[model samples]
Target: MATTTRERLISLLSDTNEYKSGQKLSEVLGCSRTAVWKHIEELRKEGYIVEAVQKKGYRITTRPNNLIPGEIKHQLDTKKLGHEIHYEESVASTQEIAHQHALKGAPEGSIVIADEQTSGRGRLGRAWHSPKRSGVWMSVILRPNIPPQKAPQLTLLAAVSVVQGIEEVTGVDAQIKWPNDILIDGKKVVGILTELQAEADRVNSVIIGIGINVNTPIEAFPDDIATIATSLKIASGKEVERAYLVRAILEKMEKLYHLYLDHGFAPIKLLWEGSAASLGKRVRVRTITGELYGNAQGITEEGVLLVEDDEGTIHRVYSADIDIPRES
Candidate 1:
């Protein structure tokens, strides 16, 4: 992967605490001083705070809270997950864009990310609330050579990745709510949606959309979900840097993805269970056909939810909305 000048510029500025002169920057970057100034201006436009002194030249004092690709790539340490990124200021949906990219032969690990998503969706076509620059709105494309029946395991894998990522970057102990949601302090903070492109019995691509309410204020949520939804800033009592969180997630995703490929879903399932919130609790699962009340046992190898009802009947829930009681 070739690093762009802007990425290199970010790296250079980030590598040291002292200011580098414009002439020196131009010399190192192999461009004229005027071009270096233009690049600095571009950085400012992207919300970087570059301190320019008379004799000391320029140094970056602050980076934006948004997920600028250059900033992310400069800090990203991943083999393939985020090597090819498609970033947008605002879009209808990263998942939709990723689907288009996948159809055009976008390689595995290609990701589509955005600052805001107007039509972001979750499982069962629920609208995902994505305000401008307040959350992690991204979709990762994976082409795993697994059977279609095993695709649901990727969703569980993603949930674990998100939980670990949040803990790694923000130091907030996040847990997974059966299937797709990540919660902190018993409130929703993250959502994962997985879509698949397959033919016959082979898997082509898996688009996993992950949305994290990073720095959004509690008041920013819609009234209907204000009481139930929370953000990382609220949980940690400080503004969480989106770029660092993004890099952490991609790195974890790439690592876990390779682990899944080389080994299998067993290891991923163990990690998921370690962070699961609903297991071993009495709960109600609502499927399209009906609702069943049971004690959440655990997940199967195929990523199906196992619920043991009152009659000692263990039911395999393929797709459903679960409700774990507060008392339980």
Candidate 2:
């Protein structure tokens, strides 16, 4: 299908925020003035504040500050990551949408992003704070030919890429919390949520959702999470452009993702273990059944955590909420 008339109008408006005459727009876009008016109406319905004047044809009044589909695609410079992005003003979760798309045979590298996720979640179904215009909430769809068992490696690979991108774009020394939370200083700055679709022990697609606190201030977060959660703005001492960070992440993620497909998880795992601060530390982890206190020796080949208790018994943790380790 050809690009929608609304998309054409948006592109025209994005080029210059000032009013472009209706006749001029129609001529530039190769469409009837009625089509231009209809497209403008649709864009207004979609929540973009557009003003129509008697002489001054149309102008973008207010842009929803976000990595929304059209805006993100306009600003992106990449071969992948967000090439097939779907952006939402509000969604229950990007992961949920990406999962549906994955099941419906979306492309291998499709992505879903939103300004606010009403039901954003993390590993083991923990709630993720996703407020509007304050973070990078995205789900990436990938169809890697890797085994189902090796899927968790993708999360580590994603974490490393996020850390690299955040540091490069925002100049913050973001650290990796074991398993998948990216932290700045001692607070959580980003959360990674990875979901898989497989059948008969063969992996089909992996939907990786990342929620990074990019611009939310300390007051914007809930009382319970504010003390522990942080944004790139707070850490970097200024507002970091969400689009730049997203592009940086996609570039790094695509490189590492391709590397993982060509080579194995060994190289990515080494990079993760290096950036990871939780390795070889005494810590407490909570699983579904109970809590386990032990030394976090390292992760196993399949991305399971290897925790050794006081009795020297090694336990492989499939999933858990790990407390940040206090330096001894």
Candidate 3:
């Protein structure tokens, strides 16, 4: 595919640390120097810091903070994951679109990302507050060759991937909570919801919904969740670039997914356990049938939680809302 003029301009400027003259850019792109100038302005409008000097041409001083597909796809390292992207301005949910694509046999690792999700969904159909231009509201479609019963393990794997990505990008030590929540300083920072399309014995596709509070302000949260929810910017005292975070997550996820497919879930399970915040702590889990108050021992091979109650009975929790241990 031929690259667009704007894309070519971005590429030329991004490929080198030194500036290229306007005449040289015009000759290479087969366009007028005025066109190059226009594209440079467009790049600036997209949040890229472009430096233009008298002797030197245009050079990109800093990358854009936005999650534009072109900005994210520029230097992404993944092979198949994120190869095909469905970008939207606003939507009800990326999971809904990913499901539609998966039903049409979309390739594994296909992703649907949106700037804002009006009706973002969490575990148990809870409303995930996803305001415009504040968070990462995206869903990934996976067509793995595994039984549907083992699908819960993917949620755990995704939590590890997210924590790794956040730590790598922002230098924040994020931890995982039970099944699929990422926390920092004992506050929620990320949430993962996994939905599957499967039959009795086989699996069609798995749509993993990931919502990360990247640059959301503390005041943006509602009164109900203000105390329990936080964002990377709020914790680190600096705004996190969403584009870099997205690429890092895709790269980490592809690596982990390949590891899971080759060596089973043992490696991912170890990583997940290492980053768990609720392990070996007194916790309360609210399930559909009833509530269980016990010590969170560990997770099973199928990614189920093993909670030991006060009566010395072990309960296997497949799905529930876990209350983290309170500070002393």
Candidate 4:
């Protein structure tokens, strides 16, 4: 993808601490000085504070916490993921738009990102609370050549990617709550919802919706989730750049995805297990079939949750809401 003028400006500003003169920027970017000045104005409008001096040129004084596409695209190191980004200020759901794009044959790694989601959904139709401009609310499109039955493994793959992204960007330790949730210090920080469009035998596309609580304030959450949900800023005691985290996720996702496609799920499975929060814990899983109480053993080869009950019967859970018991 060709970088935009704004992206080039951001790159130049972020690549160094010294001020970049307008003439130098124009000469390097092959644009007129007026165009460079306009781009700098545009960057200021996007919440970046650029310091301009009489002869010292311009330097980035501060950056916005918002996940503007230009900022994210400029930092992305992936070949395919986030190549085509559809950004929105507010939307009912990124998943809905991503599904529409996927059905219309949107390329793999096309992304639908929003500043806020009015009706964001989590697993089992739970409403995901996404306030305006406080989080990363986006959905990623994937067209892997895998069977429909193996699609659930993609959730694990996404979980690993998100965990890695959070760790790399925030420096806060986080773990995966099996299947799709990411937790920091036992509080949920990220959620992944994977939806597939498929026929009976084959798979067409997979929409992976990833909602991250990056800079959300504690009070922004409802009373019900305030204690359980946390943001990277909350966990790290400092605000994290949303664009940097988003770029990290795409990079990790692309690398892990190629690993899955070439070597298979074994490597991804091991990585997922290493960061899982539910493995070997006593828990209650509420699935569509029924509730199961047992020791969370591990995941099956197909990414199914394996729970060993009291009688030594191992149950393979396809889908469920897990609740790990706490010590009395």
lDDT at 107 for candidate 4? 93
Number of clashing pairs per prediction, in order: 0, 0, 0, 0
* TM-score between candidate 4 and the true structure: 0.94
lDDT of each: 0.91, 0.84, 0.89, 0.90
TM-score of each: 0.97, 0.82, 0.92, 0.94
lDDT of 2 by residue, 36-109 (tens): 88888877776778877898878887665557566656555566667677878789999999999999998876
Error of 3 at 118 (Å): 1.1
C-alpha lDDT of candidate 1 relative to the true structure: 0.91
Q: Please write out the lDDT profile of model 1 over residues 1-53, one tens digit for every residue.
A: 55788888988887457888999999999999999999999999988899899
* lDDT of candidate 3 over 1-328, digit per residue (tens): 2246776677788855799899999999999999888888888888889888788887888886777677767778898877777889899999999999999988888889999999999988899999999999999998889999999999999999999999999999999998878999999999999999999888899999999999999999999999999999998999998878988999999999999999999999999999999999999999889888999999988899999999999999988899976879
The lowest-lDDT stretch of 10 consecutive residues in candidate 3 is 1-10
- RMSD to the hidden true structure, all candidates: 1.2, 3.9, 2.2, 1.7
TM-score of predicted structure 3:
0.92
**Residue lDDT tens for model 4, 1-328:** 8666777788888744699999999999999999999989988988899989889789888888777777789768899998888899999999999999999989999999999999999998999999998899999999999999999899999999998888898788898887789998789999999999999888899999999998899989999999899999999999888888999999999999999999999999999999988888898999877888999898978998899999999998877888876667
Off by over 4 Å in 2: 1-64, 308-315
lDDT ranking of the models:
1, 4, 3, 2
Q: Which stretches of candidate 3 lie over 4 Å from their true place?
A: 1-8, 22-38, 53-55
Please give the distance, in angstroms, between residue 246's alpha carbon in candidate 3 and its true position after superposition.
0.9
